[model samples]
Target: MNLSIFFEPLNEDVFANLEKPRTLGSYISYFVSKFPDWRAADIAILGVDETRGRSNEEQAEDASTAETPARLVRRKLYSLNKGAGRCQIVDLGNLRPGISLDDTYLRLKEIVEVLISHNTIPVIIGGSHDLEYGQYMGYEHLERVVNMVTVDSSVDMTEDPSVPPNKRQLRQILMHEPNYLFSLGQIGYQSYLTEPEVMATLEKMHFEAYRVGEVHRSIQEMEPVIRVADLLTFDISAIRHQDAPASEPANPFGLTGEEACQLCWYAGLNDNLTSLGIYEYNPELDDRELTAMMIATMIWYFIEGFYHRKNETNFTSRHFTKYAIAFTEDNPDRMTFYKSKNSEKWWLEVEPLSAEKGTRIVPCSYEDYLQATKGEVPHRWIMTQARLG
Candidate 1:
């Protein structure tokens, strides 16, 4: 695909000022005079300036003034010191907004599909949360059921006609034709902000929803959930207004900046997760670009975790410790779990009902193994079984 035509080169004046030695900008190859060679890259960073999907048209109009949200984020990201990993990252430049919002989505979908087809992970920045629908659609032709993890303050599933696309994109994804979405797991959603009917609907469909308080109780438990995702979309509104004041309708209660980074780290470590999007940051509303820096740090942690992946899926290998548990004497159902010696991560094997289906390896936690040891089936195991059945 001739990608250059779809993107506008990064503003040289903004990045040229990043003259600090050993900074991340010094290590990254980005589009300025020409598009970087993305074919050999491990990860590609792409920015989208589109914000027409936002509910507040005034805010969207203000976004187009001078420094875009994406550019502001880039400025912060470039100023940071280089990570420990040897970086082969490319910045694809900001995408040119199409004549219509739907047209912009189509362009994003095409770009994402092309990058993923070459095994390059796309780390998307800027735009409204609604752009996630385009990111999800990129996997349509990949011929596999996709598991998604979304971190947001609200469910974004509204059916109200007056609601803008950013607030209702999740419903579009759930009801999209030629459905390939296998499961959706939401994290950091505030109960008061979410509709009771939508919550019940998600439950009836067997989808997972984690309340903000639940995430606060134990952020570690959310790792297994994130580990199973093929794509992840994080809205800055999931962070507290004090920490991320640039968010649309900033909430007083949400994840802390540190907790948000931890989730990104977990997502990066997942071999299954192919793409990530960080959205809903309005630079105009920011407190001296503090929110922009927060988002940049989150991206930094994700990239750092990416280089630390162990790739430990082989159960028969010497790098794993296996445990077998029989659920009950009468039930005679046995479950197997594998713990990675390299990373201490856990996974369980689910037996397939038919020969054609084959066995499935599900990401899990040490707690799940303990549940089995006590003669009880883990909820995750039950959910996987139900979904597979």
Candidate 2:
């Protein structure tokens, strides 16, 4: 179902989030072209608005019962037929009506399964970080894939899987075998997680992350952490509190709008980027000029990432806009880097020459580094940097 056509009034709650001076859609229409490149040809974007609240939850009453307000999914004609390559955007905001969050997730999964089986990439936009419960579930059958990345401000690590009214982290649900899930950008920590060590546990599992201070450097420097994942799962909250705060994670850590776009571009360019999801965008908390616009622009960045891969283009300029604060910690199992042949997932990959081994780069680290596998059975580390600006 195409979901981006319809325009609706903002919900009453999260009114504070919507306290913007201008409209966001307008901003998206204005500046999407001036951002990161995404792998549009290789990866398809599915924008789903399957967000819902339980009858007992606080915002349950605010959901719209509309069937098809504006369905982008319907318009694209991105079928799962043979040779169905390329990522398509599926706006779930209209596909299913009045379904529980669980059911909605299942419904989304059915569509995703169809795409994945056809060897088409699914760049999913979301209802919540919770929807991934089903996304992760669907990935089990894919043979070559076994990794998922969560780019957000909070870990969502608490364990309790009941339902809309009461649910928990993947630790509660994905219990069978260990999954290669990583969490980046749990910066600007607030009360969402009960403990600070939740971050530590995630790191222990290789769910690496950065604080507000760490991301201050260029995203170019931090690429190693996320490069390891098969799929890059982006939570909109990963953006800063000032940048895009209309989503579930309003108070995010470091990284500017450009870095977020770059990361999405990285996903779009990657060859192994099996799936991508961007979530927690609440119209309630967005400013017409800032939040929503930022989202739309970011969406363009995802596309830009893909396009660059398809055309083998370079950024207008790439001197690391956010590289001042790249700090490297004393990581025992610190990541080694690698290089790629410019074809990132959508088209993004890695490549690098022989570099001395010193673990983390001292001072502020470069965010451009990514974790790529080079050996047999398992993966080996090789350091890579983008074509110098």
Candidate 3:
């Protein structure tokens, strides 16, 4: 019911801080152009001003302009609201001399506050994962802040000085909130986090993690774990190296290209969702066609699920899906195949006992899972299909 746009300036310092260069804006623009429906949905962008870095010849030409502001400027890019869509551009020039994190946070906070007040979900094209700290802070006003889900190859919880400045100080977000906190598809385990402390911390917090194989095994088991989530943060590193190879660690594992897009689509399908972010991509690492193609696909699927979530998104039929049980109790290990054509949601599509809805005791370890499958029976839905708010 409420919506607007905001922009964040990106530049070299931002790159230096984040350990990656700006890559999301143009891709987003391309995406909007490709799928005009999403353009009609929301408008926002974040980046640094390029005008400040204009070449000598360009600066001279600008100076020759009759208008003072035109004469002073060199280059800057803003979000284009070409039609009924609200296109808001948030771009900045070089850090004037020097800027503090406090200043940066303040600037970001102002825009975030507006989104929160309007209760509008933000689809962020990130500058750095550190921006997450500020983004999380903005949601404090909510009575219940949903669990935070971060998908990356490394634990990112490390704040090693040797690490780049803009790299996520991921450890800071690790706190027990009586909320459902989880991470997935971390592949560069040994190299990125080589300490017992990291594993111990997750164990202590009851946080579960997955390497590629493990995450896949748990994919069907994720309905309830994900149902409790409040917001989703995708580091892009969760993407395979071939798809988004420019991530901070640049090492991605778990899931194939199809699986990666499925994750984005599923995350957007959650009902209790607040916002989504895709971060840690370095355009500099990509060639023209390959790199952009991968991230572009991710965005496309993300928007796909979001649109479907707006409705009950259903399909006549899809491949049979499995909903894993949390425990091996009376319900032994098994997978439910949807023999009937029903709800398209992988989880909601399957019926535990019979082909009809409301038959068997739906398999779920958590309450959100039960709620997520509110309308259907067991084996009829994908875990992600039901658990979201």
Highest lDDT against the true fold, candidate: 1
- Lowest summed lDDT window (length 10), candidate 1: 56-65
**Regions of model 2 farther than 4 Å from truth:** 1-43, 53-93, 160-167, 172-194, 252-254, 310-389
Consecutive 10-residue window with the lowest summed lDDT within model 2: 380-389
Model 1 sits at a Cα RMSD from the real structure of 1.8
TM-score of each: 0.96, 0.59, 0.56
Q: Per-residue lDDT tens digits of candidate 1, residues 236-279?
A: 99999989999878688999999999999998898888899999
Arrange candidates by lDDT, highest first: which order?
1, 2, 3
lDDT of each: 0.89, 0.45, 0.43
- Rate residue 200 of model 2 by lDDT: 59
**Best candidate, TM-score-wise?**
1
Give one digit per residue, the lDDT tens place, for model 2 in 156-233: 665534444212434533353444332222332333443566655654544345554565644554454454456666
Q: What's the lDDT of the predicted structure labeled candidate 2?
A: 0.45
Residue 251 displacement in candidate 1 (angstroms):
0.7
